[model samples]
Target: MSDASRSGVTPRRPPPMAPMGKARYRVMMTLVALGLALLAGRIVDLHVFDRSFLQGQGDARTLRTDTIPAHRGMITDRHGEPLAISTPVVTLWANPQDLPEDDIQRLMLANALGQELDALNERIARYAEREFMYLQRRMTPEAAQQVLDLRIPGVHAREEYKRYYPAGEVTAQLLGVTNIDDQGQEGLELAYQPYLAGVPGKRRVLKDRRGRLVRDLAMLQEAQPGGDLTLALDQRLQYMAYRELKAAVTENDADGGIVVMLDARSGEVLAMANQPSYNPNNRAGLDPQGLRNRAIVDVYEPGSVMKPLAMAAMLETGDLPLDTVVDTSPGWMVIDRFTIKDIRNYGKLTLAGILEKSSNIGMSKLALRLDDPVVPAKYRALGLGQSPGTGFPGESTGSIPAPVRWSSSQWAALSYGYGLSVSALQLASAYTAIANEGRRLPPSLLKLGQSPAGEQVIDPDVARRILGMMDQVVEPGTGARRALVPGYRVAGKTGTVRKTDAGGYQEKAYRGLFVGIAPVSNPRIVTVVMIDHPRGDSYYGGAVAAPVFSRVAGNALRLLDVPPDARDPES
Candidate 1:
């Protein structure tokens, strides 16, 4: 400052400062250029050469491939009524490592999830070593949404399906149930699993830091919807049968019951129901017995119901005629030291009279005339002693002693319906031969477009003659009179079978059964009702099972619009 004040021109003169030294300037410029080059190289490497690695690292945190759930198939009755369906549900899951460390956030999450705080803490601790854990499964979307809205770290929502049964216990045993993962576990559901469970899908999506889906990027696979299944069940008829059968079982105070109604022409199962059924939709504390489809799985002695087929066999041998008569003065006979008795004696009875009175002695005489194998052969020919071919799981092939060897007592018992076991379904199917003019159609659970060509198991004339004789069993007002319908001709047989134990037959336990065809002039439906261990005053098939048949048959015929055909319209 003093120098400038002293000399006025001093500022201009003091110096044109020398330019920066060349080497130092060059070194500084070079250093700056080198730094910029390194930066440029790094940018190029990140955008091109190392692009995948950098992008992959970023994507590891934000992008994810997720599973898209598939909806299971719908099961409908023959008339397009819903029976079983799949409803949308949500499942909550978590990544333990990504969970919030704060206790407050965890508490909020536990409350929203409807879990006890202690339990949630225990669960989280148990799975701390695991990256993935299921928090809750198969929750309603509304319920799961509440938990998801908390935005708790590591929590996620997955779309899933839960099976819903529309018919509830009405169709439980038949439709069966799926597992927690929606895989079929029993019944027709198990039979048709591959056809019902559709293929799942995959998709790529972007998520935020908190694991919330930001946007869908691309579909890796398209989900395939399951195929729809239409069964041969008539829901209306099924309800009717179920109601009538349940009422009978309750009124009789029976242990259990089964009713199988079949279309005689098409062989489609119209309605099959069992007592003590469980709701498939909710199966907590379910008794395993409630899951049995008793119609197709349980076998018992056919009792007196086997008489028609036996008589048919006798006629087929040309050894007896419909007008043939037998003497029953004593009311009982001894075959191999075993007594075969009738309810009472009618002295001499014609073949038609024998059936009308359900004469055990008369059938015994006819059986004595035939070869030992004749009656058993007739049963086997009529679809007994075999699976009914209904595509059901655990279908039983009922047992019959091989005709190769036997006893006179056994043969005589067989003629009157004993010494052999048949399922309710097999019995119903056997009656189809008598109802369908000796043609035995394979039983079906699925609907068919037309009636199948059937196997002829007996002479059409023999079947017709047998049907003619059974007409008297109902019309006489002596046997099975309770089975009479208001405006239809009914004909069938009743059976009261003594249950067998490890030792022998039980005197107190009896199964009452009835198999019948209605409007005997045309014979459209074959219905079988079986009540196991009826404890009421009467356990006779004519008393217990026939009334159930009358109710179910009357209602079913009207529902199908089959016109009434009784000679006296109001009886």
Candidate 2:
């Protein structure tokens, strides 16, 4: 061929090497080569595989993780009566960054989210750069549903529990309330949080397209409900006592009032009532003053009600005898720089006469003799300056200055209840030692498997001697004339102390206090009453607080079927 012709035809180069070309052979060889390739592919897929694409697509098919909320436990009283309960509350949450694309739904949601708009806006503005933020928490179920119906993307509802009070302010001082997050904040709820609150459980669940729970992945551990409480309280007695306490505060136009009832034999508190009280369910509306459980929270000079405790301490230490006598002037006496005065004085006062008259001068002198080195030891033995451990949190350790802290006026003032401060309940408990035949019982609000046999701090004989003097105050003296219970021998004392005002004492605003035991034969209850800042003309305990105690005790005794120590012949 000519060179030109060969170049033009271009060498056709042996079919440029078809890789394995129809296979050097037969149809069986070709099929066998295909089979081998298919097997190789299968082996690679089964062992040394890359499943990234498949896993990514599978994840999109369903959820990657599951989560579930734990159920809160219930709280009940000693008798199985529900005092505090946990109810489901729904809260709205959002991922504003992923706000729904639907304009109409957004508008509807914005409107349903009224009232909390400002707060919601603030929250959104803060996390404007973030992925998610809670819009509203502690929402009512109805409100949560309305928000959910908007069907906004990244917007959802979560369930939590809120505390509820069935008895409301009636049991507020003892039961206390929990915060919106179901955490204990005060009272028995706070003190016993560990046992009363349950451990949270975890659950994993798969959600559907609509965010509904479709599958439960796992339940890590079964949550245990909170154990129930058996209180020392009787509901009937609590209501009656609160009613009386409220009425006294209202009638006397006093700033506040407190009523505490203790079972005489057992030191268990049967009822604790404080007026100007707040509803735990509506804590948002409560005023700061209304939140105080005055019986155990506020400290005051217990006034003349402390006279008996002072005198008992005196006799217990042999500082004074029941028959001891002193010269008491008309109604006053002069001490060093501070002149001491009495409500009224007797010409010649016996030791018992000092108690009957509530003579400040007499108590002051008696206290002078009681200034033994053992005074501090005696006070400690009485449990002063220590918490009552009554299962009520934040109960103040009523102030009792150390011996080194007491100045010259302090010794005398301590006897008249000026230098020392004590909660109304503490004074009530001290009187309990006197009425209880000298055993200093520890006060308790919890239901005990057994009550400790209290230590005998005072001889029963000395205690009864003190009790007799106190009983006299009730019979022919200021207390009995006011705290009159028809059949019951109400042994108690009246107290009137000028309250400490701003920088100094308010001579006008007095704390009227009374503490007593009823049904002398088998003392069933110790009633303590205190009225703060009474504006009425009669502001003394004999006028304002004791009457309330009589009314409350009368009803409580009858309701508890303690057999009215005596029925009001007038009633």
Candidate 3:
């Protein structure tokens, strides 16, 4: 330093340094050691003890488990015609925190979504704390894609399903519709919901800071799609029945109507259509009444339609034979001040003649002679007073009262179809016994692999005789010529019952009903037609209801390729 200082210009004065003390040196060295130790301990704690918690916290923001919506099941007719199906759709969701805060960007998003700007703002504010919310649910894929093309942050489309009914209103009341969540709410859909709904799947996914999905990590569970359901309903027959029932209701200026056709051998419902039907696809303001499947739900006192059943009951007593005769004086009689009358004076009628003439007096005498429980018990065995067991929701077990005392008037009223209520399905099923030679098979809406074992409710000979008597009613009795098919022998009964109110029966309000089986020699199709409150020229079942039976039964028989038993006389 002295040499440099002498040679160079006062060379660099050694930077002045403070004197070093032992205590100060030790203090500085101790501080440096403490600082390194604290850092090393922190690193160990963070990488070892707190590692999992830290990782989980970080993943809570950057990773998410998403649900993959499963597709709902399909509903088809017996012939594989689609009744209801699920179509692919998209749902839009958002993370409120990740959404654009700029008013202009938000306004663009609102416009793209067809929502008001103010509404969008309110919704975002409401969900400010939530990371997820649905923007729009169940939108068409193309429609949802249009908005996603805006490239808005936090906006995402999720795959989902929308239900579509191919048969539209034609199958509406039967197949029913799903809710926005794709859950069944009514009809057969509601009955089989457990089998129709699928399990949703979960998957872990990576998300960017803006909460937009980047990539799928791993599937936590696989989506399980719902199973398909096949019904026994025949679409062609259903359409025909719907068309005819609609026309009959319109022509008669009736309130509403129901037409139910059953396969007599298998007890499978072939066609069931109700009036005042609604389009399930568009149920924005549907009346709940329009959704009623009258064939299985609504009940009515089926006037003379009960006569055949009563006759069956009487014959089951073994006290009355088909050829036995009874005197019907003046065509009328009195019981409990209730006047039960026939159409006119058919002074004396054989048991078969009573049904042929639809004689109330003759039927009253027969019922009064039997024990009260006999008729009610026989009706129960014939599937009346019970649900048809079609597994249909809201199925009515029609009321057949067990009166404390069976009065003469009660017996008289019961004889001609009063004092008890029966649904169209019940009546149709009851006649299945006569149609199937005295065996009443359990009614089914599912296509059966084989016919179920039947409960024999009546003797084969009596059912045959009753079938023959009903054939006479259609051909030369009260069913009127209008019920006749040109190329088939029809067996049926007519019923005209005055609709009752809280007070009493309404004279002007009547329900016309016809229950029939076609090709009586070898019965195949059994049909029931009901018209409520028909106006104009006639309100009788023979006039309003029988003709509908003719059209529906005639078409159904031909559609089934049931060989016509009644040869065409001209041919």
Best by lDDT: 1
- Could you give me the TM-score of model 1 versus the true structure? 0.89
**Model 3 pairs whose backbones collide:** none
TM-score of each: 0.89, 0.84, 0.91
Q: Point to the candidate with the largest TM-score.
A: 3
Q: Which stretches of candidate 2 lie over 4 Å from their true place?
A: 1-68, 110-129, 139-153, 208-214, 369-376, 405-409, 476-479, 566-571
Per-residue lDDT tens digits for candidate 3, residues 3-98, read 767787654566655667667898999999999999999889988988998899889989999998887888889998889899998999999988
TM-score of 2: 0.84
Candidate 2: 10-residue stretch with minimal lDDT: 64-73
Q: For model 1, where is the 10-residue window of minimal lDDT?
A: 9-18
The clash tally of candidate 1 reads 0
Clashing pairs in 2: 78-230, 78-231, 474-480, 487-566
True-structure lDDT of candidate 2: 0.76
Candidate 2, residues 352-437, lDDT tens digits: the string is: 87887788888777777654734445566777777877757678887778777565567887776777777867766776788789
C-alpha lDDT of all candidate models, in order = 0.89, 0.76, 0.88
TM-score-based ranking, best first?
3, 1, 2
Candidate 1 per-residue lDDT over residues 177-213, each given as its tens digit: 9999999999988999988998989999999876779
- Looking at model 3, residue 526 earns an lDDT score of 87
